[model samples]
Target: MKVRAYGKLNLTLDVLGRRPDGYHLLDTVMQSISVWDELDIQTSRQPGVHLQCNKDRLPTDSKNTVYRAAKFFLEDCGLADQGVYIFIKKYIPSRSGMGGGSADAAAALRGLNEMFKTGLTTEQLMAIGARVGADVPFCVMGGAARCTGVGANVEPVAPLPDCWLVVCKPPAGMSTPRAYSILDQYPLSSTQATPRMLEALEAGNLKRVAKCLGNRFDETIRLAPVRALKRAMVDAGALGSMMTGSGSSVYGIFVSEDQAREALETIDSMGRTFLAQPCSGI
Candidate 1:
């Protein structure tokens, strides 16, 4: 079986608190975008997982999350005899707070489930995914959602209204560990959640949705070049814009397709650009 896993952007991410497990508790609005990776999996006569990818940035070893995920699932279910090869075509930039790797791993799990007919429930898949990474579970079940409890707890949120998205990535990658450390060392500034946008989404109000868009990470990430790109996009005509995840890539939401293309040209980068829209579900 083959599956295409899509990347995610955070419109609103607030670190609620640190957990006893040492992972931070989070309250974030996550939206899946069109930027995606494809994973192909099928039963193999060979005895173990074999993986290949066109992206040199991605490691093909067992250290790779997708390889680890397939191992985790088969070992957990005593399906070690099943063998497979995964071919991944990646477009999402790595470590840009875009959840590319996590999405790839989730896609592998989903493909395996179908190939094996495991009939694993969503909760079961999520539980297995969580063991791999905090964002893994959420990626497994694609869509817009409110994620909490270190990304394990996912509550369905109304999808953001149909809008064009322009994403920008900076040259420097923001280390997730470093971002966490920075947050730990520094006092985090607070921002109000976009309850109005959430309401707008539920009501299918595109204008209101654009008006209510917001993210708390702006205070930290905006100190860098990424903030400038985001500003450029907005100034060029994005209806709404914000930094996506921990740092680096930012997205501009636009009402008109033509407006979105214009916004992208304003922020055109050697880095990367993904022109996409809000999807209903994963």
Candidate 2:
């Protein structure tokens, strides 16, 4: 089974309080982008999971989300005796807050269900995915949604208006845990980012939607390359630009593909770049 796992972007991320379990509460609007990681999985009678990746640095053992996800799903299906050989071809940049690992985990669950003929519904798959990662539920469902409660609770929302976007990851990546730790030092903002973003999408006003772009983590992380990427996007004609998720990667909402391409080139030297649009769920 071959699955294309799409990466995500946070148009608006608001930090709430933290739970007793140390999980930070959040209200973030998520959208799946065109950037993706491809997984080719094959089942075998041998009772163990083997994994490989194009990026040699990425772990292929239990440390990898893909391997863990396969194990979890197989155990759930009462197929623990089954084995899978999984290969990942990565396009989405890691450690950029793009949910690359979560996406891979989600894809493994979905592909395994199909390959083994397990009739798990989307909700079931998403529920199972949540155990693997906080963002895995959203990645499993894909497309647009308001994710809250440590990003496992996903409420589907209207897709963003058709448009082009440019995403760039700075040379240095941000640690999600470290980013959250830094953000925890600050108080929660009164600004209602997700509500306004929902309204903007519902109204089908791209410009208004662009104005809704926001992320609390971006405010906390003072990375120079991130700021430069946003600045170049704005100067090159982006409607609005901001860092997605925690940090490292920044994206710009553009009026046209041409403008998006220009912004990509403008900031390409600063880091890795991708030109994409909001897409639907798997």
Candidate 3:
């Protein structure tokens, strides 16, 4: 079976607090973008997970998150007796505030569940995913959500307004580990994105939602050139704009798809751009 693993962007990410376990408590609103990676999985007569990457950018070994996800699922289901070969075709940009790797891992779990008839419940799948990475659980269960408790506790929320997104990625990639380290050095800013955007969403007010969108990490990440790209989008008449995850990639929301395409054209003149709509559901 084959699956398309959709990438995500955080329209509103607020670090609520830090946990005793060194993980940061979060109140984030994340939506999958149209950007995705293609995964092909088939049963193998062999006894271990084997991975192949068509994209040169990603690793084709156990170190890769997709391999680890396959390993985790097979072991958890006592299907270690079985094996599968995964062929990955990457399209989403890595380490650019997009959940490329996480999405791939999530897709693997979903694919294996269907192909192997594992019968693992959603909660069980999420639990296994959490052991792999913080973002894995959410990707396994897509759609808009309010994530807390180191991003594992997910509360399904109403779908976000349909808006076009223009994303710009700079040449430099921001490491998540390094971003968290710098976060500790700075004083705690406001964890305001969730509450404000939640109100807008409940009201189904697109204008208000656009106006209220924010990310706390932007306060620190704005020093990079990607910020300039966001500013440029605003100059081109974006309804609202912000950096998605950690840093190095920024996006602007527009009222119409046409406007978004125009904004993308502006970015394409200078840098890479992804034009996509808000994902409605999984």
Which structure among the candidates has the greatest lDDT? 2
Off by over 4 Å in 2: none
lDDT of 1 at 199: 76
Residues 1-282 of candidate 1 have per-residue lDDT tens digits of 668889998877877678776788787778888888888777778978999998876789887889988999999878998788889888788867889889998888888888888999878888888888888888988888888878778888888777888888878677788777777765543555645556777898776766666655566545467767767877988777777778678888888889888877777763677789876425
lDDT of 2 by residue, 94-175 (tens): 8898999999999999999999999999899898888888999999999999999899999999888999989998888878
Instruction: Supply candidate 3's per-residue lDDT for 260.
Output: 84
Count of clashing pairs, candidate 3: 0
Global Cα RMSD, each model: 1.9, 1.0, 1.4
lDDT at residue 3 of model 2 (Cα atoms): 97
Q: For candidate 2, what is the TM-score?
A: 0.98
Backbone collision count in every prediction?
2, 0, 0
For candidate 2, the per-residue lDDT at 227 reads 86
Candidate 2 has its poorest 10 consecutive residues by lDDT at 183-192
Global Cα lDDT for candidate 2:
0.90
What tens-digit string does per-residue lDDT give for candidate 3 at 48-145? 89999887767888779999999989998888999899999988887788888888998898899999887887778788888878888888888888
Provide the lDDT at 220 for model 1.
56
